[model samples]
Target chain A: MSTPRTPTIGLFGLGAFGRLILRHLGPHFPLTVHDPVHHDSAPPERAAACDIVILAVPVAAMAETCAAIAPHLRPGTLVVDVGSVKIEPARVMQQTLPAHVQIVGTHPLFGPQSARDGITGRNIAVCPVRGRAHLRIAAFLRRVLGLRVILTTPDAHDREAAVVQGLTHLIARVLVEMEPLPGRMTTASYARLMEAIDMVRGDPPGVLAAIETANPHARPVRDRFFATAAAVARRFESGDAGGEDQRRRSRRALIG
Target chain B: MSTPRTPTIGLFGLGAFGRLILRHLGPHFPLTVHDPVHHDSAPPERAAACDIVILAVPVAAMAETCAAIAPHLRPGTLVVDVGSVKIEPARVMQQTLPAHVQIVGTHPLFGPQSARDGITGRNIAVCPVRGRAHLRIAAFLRRVLGLRVILTTPDAHDREAAVVQGLTHLIARVLVEMEPLPGRMTTASYARLMEAIDMVRGDPPGVLAAIETANPHARPVRDRFFATAAAVARRFESGDAGGEDQRRRSRRALIG
Candidate 1:
């Protein structure tokens, strides 16, 4: 049993983002970790029975992990997920976890690479699922962890994250695949784009999959992006960009 | 002639970039400026006959600008261009201008927007065409202008820049057209991408046109990018990304 001051936090999964959470949360809470490999520091039931359960596993493994721990969750305990998407994970947790356990869905905006220095000031979207316990979670994330907490619903979080995370990861995936890019002779925008790519290229593959596939809103955003990008490509390729004089005039007007 | 110590510099096309040049070079040299509009302070012939001539015109107007100034250029005078691409401008200058004048092709890697603060550490590509005078220009750019001058041939500059400027502008173009991108709940990478887009979104349309079409090497890079990006979109849309366990293993491998 945890002391009243320090709650027990059961963290499932030890991936890159999981370790980041561990690094921060370990100082404040008593931790019981479970991983598919040999990193299980406690029994699955013991971890699930803690005061707070944190599922850091991929969306693919959420169902299995939730099922394995479902029977052991104590009444009045809090269950949280740090998935990239909100709606899918929120559904899986709400459906699988016991109705007595409180659920909060959070999407941490910074990746392991981006948060290498620290998680301070980084944004986290907190979606309240089954209970008002999200207020407590959001407060802890805000005051104790030095994070920027955005309280939102599952659908609302997914809609914005569809374009935010979806397009970013998609761009990062393609840019990283196009490696050996020019390191010199780069413009400021190119440098910024490359920096953006660097921040997400090292993200786990599951993160990309979850961002692109798990979120329902990602498809329409992707459709719009590809459609718009293809049109731009065709215009440039066909050399049918708007009239040179008008563009020059507009540029001059802005400059003057 | 003002004095032997201060040579007159003829600046043509007083657009945004031309104004940037005037701001920097005006303090150092005796300036004679000309523009297509009412900003022409000197006769076109007088501007062309200055000791050194700088062309800050668009690629579309390069031929006409060069033809207008060709007959007035003095022997042993130096002519330089600050175009986005090198090969086309270099060809225009070499073919149109008299062989008696020295020519240097330079692409100031930073635009007026990027150089808003200053150009102290920015990059400038110098391609020597018909003269040994590029040596002096490179020295002045390195020493006086505080620019990192990359000396290369027209072909080499275009080849490398095709990827550097080509893809950056292309991506910026598409992303900008996808306006009202989510500002809140943005990841670090998304923020970086937005910064990149902001830096180039205001670019004159001619700059984008020159980067995409005027540079011969841009087409192949664009084709490759579009092809790879399409494949990525297809894979994600079809949900045919690699095996989930494989990705998890790789992510765990990286994290652990």
Candidate 2:
């Protein structure tokens, strides 16, 4: 049992983002970390006994991890999963956890790379699954961590993320594959684009896959994005020699 | 005739980019400004009388503008066209200007928006088309303007730009249309990408059209880009329920 002075936090999955969360949250709360591959990590039962249990695994492992920890959690344990897409994790937590346990679905928009300077002022979206604990957690995230809290539903977060993250990863993957030499010759915009690509350059293949597949809305947005690109490319290729002018006019009409 | 201490310079376009050049070069040289629509601007013949002539028109107007001013230029006058793509403009300058008039093809990689703060350490690609004027111009651009100069052939510039500018504008156009609300929720990369798009958002339709069409190398690169995107999207759409695993494996093979 945690006293009012120091509530124990069990941080599951000590990956890059998970470690980041630990760095910020560990200083304020008594923390116990558990990673499957880490020899130093505590056992699942130890984490389940903590006041707050944060599941920081990849979206693919969310369901399995939640199922593994559900039976060990106490009646009032607060279970949180920080997945990029909220809908799946929200559903999984609601279904797997006991009625007495609380669930909060969170997506920290910035990761280790982005939060290197600091996590202050970064945005975090929270979707409360089955708890009033979210109100207290949101306050803690804002007041202690200095993060901007966006309280939204799981569906709303997924719908917006479908365009935000889906298109970002899609374009970045293609641009990186092209191996563009946007060196010193880069225009201001090109330099910004390259900077964006470099940020996600180190992300794992699994993370990229989950961003594309785990969110149901992401597929439809990806389809529309590629189709729009293909349609524009086709117009450029099939046009007459003098078709450049017509194409310009049409583009203005379409985009403007 | 002008003294070595102060060369009379004529700027023949006062558009956004041209004004940026003016803000930098105007104070150094005895300047004459000309724009066809501006009532207070000097006529073409007046610009022709200057010791150095700079045409900062869009790529589409390069040939016609060069032709209009060709007859008025003195035998020893240096005529330079600051165009984005080099091969076409280089050819236009070489064919239009008289043998006695020197021509230098200059593409200032940074523009009004890019150099808004200042152009110190920015890059400028100079392709020598005719005579030794390029040597002097290059030195002036490097020493006085504090620009990093890349001396390359017109073909090389066009070839590299095909990938750099082509892919940038292509990706930006689609993402901008999606109206991504990348404000506070932006990851590090998405923020950079948005910054890049913002830089080019105000560019005229003509500039976008020229970037796609004027550089012949851009077409093939654009084709490969769209084809690659289509292939990836198709794989995602056609794969079974467990497609994410297969897709990630294939993307690893393809990109890695």
Candidate 3:
């Protein structure tokens, strides 16, 4: 076969993450972007002609967007998604897209700030459906974007993310609700908690909702975090000797 | 009545805070130094003689040190203890010292790193037992050292510190126990926690042990923290249609 032309990138959804990708890859690749809310502000036309189509929308809108874009994609086009919850969107892409197109799901374990700042030392999980397009895309991401691509099943990706992101953010929400932060001269631990809180503080509500509601495995992890915190609290309120006794018993149980 | 001469400062406990004070005040005052461990290796004689008498030792040895140095302290000598816990040491000073020597129990909120550089803008809690030494000490601390003096009862000081320092360190101990951190890229929140852990990482074991065991108020505050964490856990674990059912039930119960 004759040499294949350089792949163009079509990005749908121009929010913070989309904007960052556009900003980073715009100068390198032809980047076309479309966001319903910001339709008039779409990326240049050259970006739309790209063979690679990236869906960078909220999880809620991912399915609808994937279905709508399937007709527009070329026969051999590779469609990839950049959303937190992978399984649902991966399934949607697989179900909606034509047989000639390839579906690859990805979740960049970072935010827009990291991407914009050119900090590429983060993990990006890839769940491929069909064709060598997934591997090609992964290679391009590695060689050009400098992302650490982790190949995994979508189910496993969602399950692990429940604990990693969901549980972490849940603990942060609880801490925020509990007490008024002391003055700046706080212990190192409290400062760390504040940092965690700050990370999740500006996240879009839909992102949290997707992780909390759409991810099938997140509830149990969130439950476990809350349970551990509650158990510690109950033991403390029971009285000094009783609390110490409970702690000792727990330690013994764990060791055994 | 004649105006009393400016009461001189006798710093007992030449650890980080003491050494810092000497570094800053050596040229200005007549400091007499005494550290059982570092008595021979202290910052040359010039910095040592600046103090009227410096008793730099552990908190546990405060009683014996006070008794031994009581004879040497002349009339109007202002002896100050820079221990973390104020109540017990303050009481020890009130009970052990001679009538001519003035005992002022002061805990500089900041530590050695704070002192070696400077003490300006930091807090110093003072529990004055006898003499107008506090006025001179407070003035010197404010003008020369730039310390913000908070005059309070020893009991009150210790009670608040039990929550501030003791509770903080307790949280650090819990977090450290949970995760073995690697030198990989971490989120902002994790970084903050690491900083807190670092602060108490190399502290004198005796200092921590004393704060944990000696402060009677510590147990309860710690207990409350655990209880709150556990309660959050229980809510998560209940699994009665996630948090929705519980929130609805609680709202109904309150309305009824």
Candidate 4:
């Protein structure tokens, strides 16, 4: 069980997702926030004494930010991350944090618009580096914030994300490359694909680079994606039962 | 200008999209409807007489259906089709309909969901085969129903649909084959992609077949899609700089 006192939360980085957190959590908790870009506009002094420190910056900056904040954290304070990629950040936090400070790595499996209210019914993946802090935080997230908690290792999270994010975004990249900007009218299916493309288009360049470059295991998954696309093209070119056969084979492989 | 006195409408097939029209316009206009599966199940007899006849069946079944309803249409009645592929149905309507009757080919660029209260503010592609009757229907759709109307030849409509529907659905088919089913939890991008896959999964097979097989020009689009995917796979396998190089090359191609 967590200590009953209200946890003071120190939020670091104020990007899009970070801003969303501040908007939702500021009224409810004792919030302290830091952003290098907004150094002159720091939060109130009371918030700096927070018991929980959250790193909500790009994945590439996670290591340096974790190192800078380690000394400021008091004993028993929890350091958590909300990065997209997990394993590397978890390793960085483990190496930089003090022995007494508990490190909990989390990837909230949603974005700002996913829920109308503050984090209700959304999934949060927690990979504990070395503490009971995860359970404490998970309890609060479920009991108070109404989040669905998923527990997994940092390694497993990245491996799965390689296919989930890597392949889907790769497909979007392909569509943008192939088609001219659509005009006049569209079907429901095309409208949906455009929505997917729009979601990823505004992501910071580093976010896309990290997902594509960091995951060594994603090569095979991407290869398989291309292979399936090739088979579909072959079928379309032939216009025989072969296309339908290929479609059936691919559907069974994916759905099964 | 349309001939004065409300032009009676002849509705040939009573499928999902057909039934919706009857529900919306049956009270105002005299509607003559025929369907092999549910000929007796059409609305009451008072809604049977119509000046314009709409053929709402699959492209493969259009010829036989046109023959069956040829004797029933009144002189000067306007004939239209609501099929995905336009050329074949347009040719059949031109060949079989009475010389006095005007022929117009229509492809409502929306599904049954858009027709809930009648297809207001939606798009309908109009391909006039041989007549002035299409002008009146187009005017009605634009002025009364608030539809966005695009007038094009039958061949052009089929060509555009080949890339829009055929290639888009082909990409959906490939993605479904390539990726594993994401459990209940996923990144925002994957969640959006799954929404697209669901839409494609639920589409009618007749729509799918018409988009895939009816367009003769779709083969080259499918070929380019496969070639580009293959190139992406090869670049990823070669390492970071190779992938970066491929990205640069693609951008250069776009610029040129």
Q: How do these models rank on TM-score, best leading?
A: 1, 2, 4, 3
lDDT of 3 at B184: 40
* DockQ leaderboard ranking: 1, 2, 4, 3
Q: Which regions of candidate 1 fall more than 4 Å away from where they truly are?
A: A1-4, A246-256, B1-4, B244-256
lDDT by residue for model 1 (B1-256), tens = 5655677899887878999999999889999888757553677888899999999887767877888899999999999999999999999999999989999999999888899999998999999999799998999999999999999988898888888899888888888888888888988889998888888887777788888888999999888887888899888877754446545564453212
Better of 1 and 4 by DockQ: 1
Docking class of 3: incorrect
Q: Per-residue lDDT for A1-256 in model 2, tens only?
A: 9666677999888878789988898779889888866776788789878999998877767767777888788988899988889998898889888898998999998877778899898889998889799999999999999999999999889888877777787777777777746575667788788778777777765567667777899898987887777766665565432355634433322200
Query: Candidate 3 chain B TM?
Result: 0.79
- Please provide, for model 4 over A1-256, each residue's C-alpha lDDT reduced to its tens digit, 9 standing for 90 to 100: 9778877898877777788888767877887777756655454232334788888776666666666666666888788888877888899889988898888888887666444345677788888888888887888778877888888889888888788777766776667667684556566666667777776766655556556665665666776766777776655556642345434432322200
Q: TM-score of candidate 1 restricted to chain B? A: 0.93
lDDT per residue for candidate 3 within B153-193, as digits (tens), equals 77887777766676666655544444553324233344445
Whole-model Cα lDDT of every candidate shown, in order: 0.84, 0.79, 0.63, 0.69
- By lDDT rank, best first, the candidates go 1, 2, 4, 3
Q: Model 4 fnat?
A: 0.31
